[model samples]
Target chain A: MMSNLLLLSLAVLAAAILGCLYRLLKGPTVPDRIAALDTIGVLLLSMIAVLCMLFRTTAYLDIILVIGILTFIGTTALTRYIERGVIIEDGDAEDDR
Target chain B: MIGEMAIGAVVLLGACIGAISAFGLIRLPDIYLRSHAATKSATVGVLLILAAAFLYFLLYLDHVSVKLLLGIVFVFLTAPVAGHLTGRAAYRSGVSLWKGSVRDDLKQEDSSAQGPL
Candidate 1:
């Protein structure tokens, strides 16, 4: 019973990912896509959490941290890009020839 | 028996919340509202799912997982900040609100920043 429920929820989360993908593909603006991507990242975390539970192993836990960090960096960079047209800018750009 | 049922229930609830949030993401009219659904709902759903996994390992295997604890904390700290940055960047980049919505506190604040005409 427990395993069945886990499997069912896994399927549901997968469906949720597909729904977010629709938004990713159809979003009218850049931020809309960014938002969807962020949401997808969170959902992916949930899916992995469930996966490790099903497999009953601690080994996959590291992957969760890696994904979370990557997602954070990606979202921050994307937002920075949209806000200022660049993810990184030199403080002394005026001095640089 | 009760433990297994509880874990299953938590996992299912989390998945359902995720699906609802994703549906809202697809159906909402504008980026602001879509992100509202995406960030808030999705974050809660993920937290619940992670908590369920934590409970499963603790009760079934008789083991403690510090990494899951760290993940829960990490996600709790970061998801809202990511959402806020996305919304702010959207507004700064001139993304329009849905036509039906009326409140824009940011726009008011922006106008108020200027000297009286």
Candidate 2:
């Protein structure tokens, strides 16, 4: 019974991922694509959680943490890059030749 | 019996909410509103699903999964920040608001700051 429920949840989540992918592909603006990417990351995390339950193992636990950390870092870096042309500030303005 | 039923129900509801959030992401008029759906609805959906897993591990297995708990906390903390940063970046990059938007509070503030007349 629990396995059945897991399957059902997985199906719905798969559909959600597809929707997010559509937006990611079709999003007109950079932020729109970034938002879709963020949503996709969250959905992927949830999918991993469901998979852990289905497999009845704790091994995937660390993977979840890794994904979360990567998502946070990636989103922050992308946002900074979008807002400022350069991701890292150069102390010397003439550094870039 | 009841525990299994509750878990199933919670997971189902969470998935449904997640689907709706994705729908909103595609259907919304602007990036701001799409971010609204993606951040709030999707965050709550994933949280609910995690809650279901937490309940299952605690009740059926008679053990707590520390990782699931950590995931719940991590998601709750980061989702909003991701959304906010994306929206702020979009605004600063000159993504225009929807045509029907009534007020331009940020624009007003910028103009007021520059005004010496």
Candidate 3:
């Protein structure tokens, strides 16, 4: 029963990710794409958590942390780029508006 | 037996929330509204699934999983920050709001006064 539930949840998360992927591809704006990507990251995180439970092992626990950190950084950097047109900013640059 | 069922129910609920949030992401009128669905409810869904994982290990194996606890905190803290950044980027980059959006309080605040310092 436990494995069945975990597998079901995993499937649902996968389907959700596919939905987000559609938005990522079809979004009219850069930020729209970024938001869909962010949603996908969160869905992937939950999916991994479910996978861990289904297998009854702790090995994937660190992966959960790594994926979360990467997602946050990726989203933040992308948004920064969209806002400033650069991933890193140096003071006194004229392009910053 | 009951504990396992509890975990299953929690995981099921998280899955449902994830599906709903994703649906909102695709169906919403524009970027801002999509961010609303993507970040808030998606964050909750991830949190619940992580919590369920924590419950499963704690109840079944009597092992304490620090990483799951950390993940819960990490998602809870950062998802909103990411959403806010995305929204700001979208607005500043001039992604127009849905026509049906009645008002933009951010726009009501003078753009000149809010220019980057």
Question: Per-residue lDDT of A1-97 in model 1, one digit per residue for the tens?
Answer: 8888989999999999999998899888999999989988889988998899888898888888889888999999999888877778888764321
For model 2 the local lDDT of residue A9 reads: 90
For all candidates in order, the CA lDDT equals 0.88, 0.87, 0.89
Assess candidate 1 and give its lDDT.
0.88
What's the ranking of the predictions by lDDT, best on top?
Answer: 3, 1, 2
* Model 2 per-residue lDDT tens digits across residues A1-97: 8788888999999999999999999999999999988888888888887787778777787888788888888899999888877777868764331
Off by over 4 Å in 1: A92-97, B111-117
Candidate 2 docks at the CAPRI level of medium
Give residue B6's lDDT in candidate 1 (0 to 100).
Answer: 86
Report the lDDT of model 3 for residue A9. 84
lDDT of 3 at A20: 92
Rank order (by TM-score, best first):
3, 1, 2
Candidate 3 residues B16-46, lDDT tens each?
8999999999898999899999888999888
For DockQ, the strongest prediction is 3
Question: Candidate 2: lDDT of A49?
Answer: 78
True lDDT of residue B9, candidate 1: 89
Docking class of 3: medium
* Interface C-alpha RMSD after superposing true interface residues, each candidate, one decimal: 3.3, 3.5, 1.6
Which stretches in model 2 have alpha-carbon errors above 4 Å? Answer: A90-97, B112-117
